[model samples]
Target: MQTQDSRARPLLIYLHGFLSSPQSFKCQLMREWLTANNPHIVFCAPQVLPYPAIAQQSLVGLLEGFLRSANCGPVGLLGSSMGGFWCTYLGERLHLPAVLINPAVRPSRFMPAYVGRVLRPYSGGTQEYRLTEADVDTMGRLEAELAQPLHSRYWLLSQRGDETLDYRDAENFYRSQRQTVEEGGDHGFQGFARYCAPIVEFLFNQQ
Candidate 1:
């Protein structure tokens, strides 16, 4: 199966969590694993914008660019936290398979705490942006998609010790899909490197 991919470069795009970047630990771990084991696969972890509307736009643009590139093959998504939420939106829209790690069920439900606060954006530089009502509203629109049944193409990875968001919400949200519920791990998700192989297999082998 690995050699078969040599004929066509399969892509694995990782989406980092909020206030995180392509260099985040999970992103780096995934990136490093792919580089060492799946040389035929193209790994992409775009630095998504902080704002909801533009973040979606950036993801879309990345996908488009990848699809247009030569030797493009099957595309899969892997997202953590907020990125997992956006990944669901994109995966459902395109009927693509995705691996979600501690995804936010309803971002708008807890987004109020972030509004109007001067927050550091991704890539963690000096520039900061205030979370606004418009950003939160855009998130609501994305959340609205959850009202319908989700495609059973997701592999959910959640930890009960997640302090920021409730693991139960994700369990209920993705009840129909595959999942891994671990105990005593925080929102960052402990020992994620352990699942690196299965994650690639699930995403890459999916149609």
Candidate 2:
């Protein structure tokens, strides 16, 4: 099969986890890999807001603009953690394929624990960001919308040893879709570089 990059310029959008930035390790790794192997591909990893509702709006706007500018091409998504939750939302809305790494299958279930003050280690500043009821509500909306899977267009990558989130949630949620359950690793997904090729293939090759 012909690669999407070979047919048209591929637009790959990387969505980082909550409190994470585009400067994340996986984002940088994918950027570097695309630069070296598929220079023709256009990669974008926009920095989204901390708030769930605001973040969804920002991502939707960014993706709309990207689609407009690209005109006609394959658009792929790569999301980790909370970003994965958003990715599933977008994938369902746009009928696009995505690669989710240790995705938060039900973020609303755990948002209550973080409803108060929180430190954003990736914020680059000492300031803290507060999670509000609206954030929790937004997560609930997203979670509710995910009641139905989008067929088999997703590539779920999870690690059994993920300390932050339960990998079984993703495993159970994406049971019918393509998935990789590793024996040992954390939420960061150690040795993620090894899957870059497969991720690219899965996202861009989907019909």
Candidate 3:
């Protein structure tokens, strides 16, 4: 459920990377900054299910519930890594503005090898979740759903040196939309904060 402040201003829904949570460093930092700098903007980062099977409809339902619950007028989506994949899928259906960070464009093809069983790392904890093939297949189907042509309502941010996801994926996917490709940065961009200012400006400035 959304908080009271979320009722005001445009909605900003953040989707963290695979095996990550809303409590991620970037998510927390953005939350604090937005709360102080743009209190009117609603910030939502739900803790999504780890498995791909539940992740698909779960994420969509969450977004739908958020919009209905808050009565959000306009919405902006920010997604990182695998979450970026989800943002693309949702953007197709919602037609809302979005900012994708090191997004996983072809995760269906990328993660096929590990479809049966996979281990995920947890943040600040020595724990991992064992994923099932069903989960991976569902995620692949979700990616397929978003394989349509790109729209103008999307923006992509990626770094060439990302070790996790190939930067080319984002470049190709969002080629028609606004894009910012950084050189020599890792999967987690070292200068994410620098990009945040412009992203916020662009999102808020949009019609």
Q: Considering every candidate listed, which one attains the maximal lDDT?
A: 1
Give the per-residue Cα lDDT of candidate 1 at 130: 78
Model 3: weakest 10-residue lDDT segment is 115-124
Score each candidate by Cα lDDT.
0.87, 0.85, 0.78
lDDT of 1 by residue, 1-207 (tens): 446645777888899888888889999998888889987788988887778888888787778777777767999999999999988988887777999999988888887888999889656688777788888999999788765579649999999999989999999989889999999999999999999999989987756
Can you give the TM-score per candidate against the true fold? Answer: 0.92, 0.91, 0.87
Better of 1 and 2 by TM-score: 1
Runs of candidate 1 with Cα error greater than 4 angstroms are 1-6, 68-70
> 151, model 2: CA deviation in Å?
3.8
Ranking of all predicted structures according to lDDT, beginning with the best and ending with the worst: 1, 2, 3
Shift in Å, residue 50, candidate 1: 1.6
How many residue pairs clash in all the candidates, one count each? 0, 0, 0
Which regions of candidate 2 fall more than 4 Å away from where they truly are? 1-8
Candidate 2 structure lDDT: 0.85
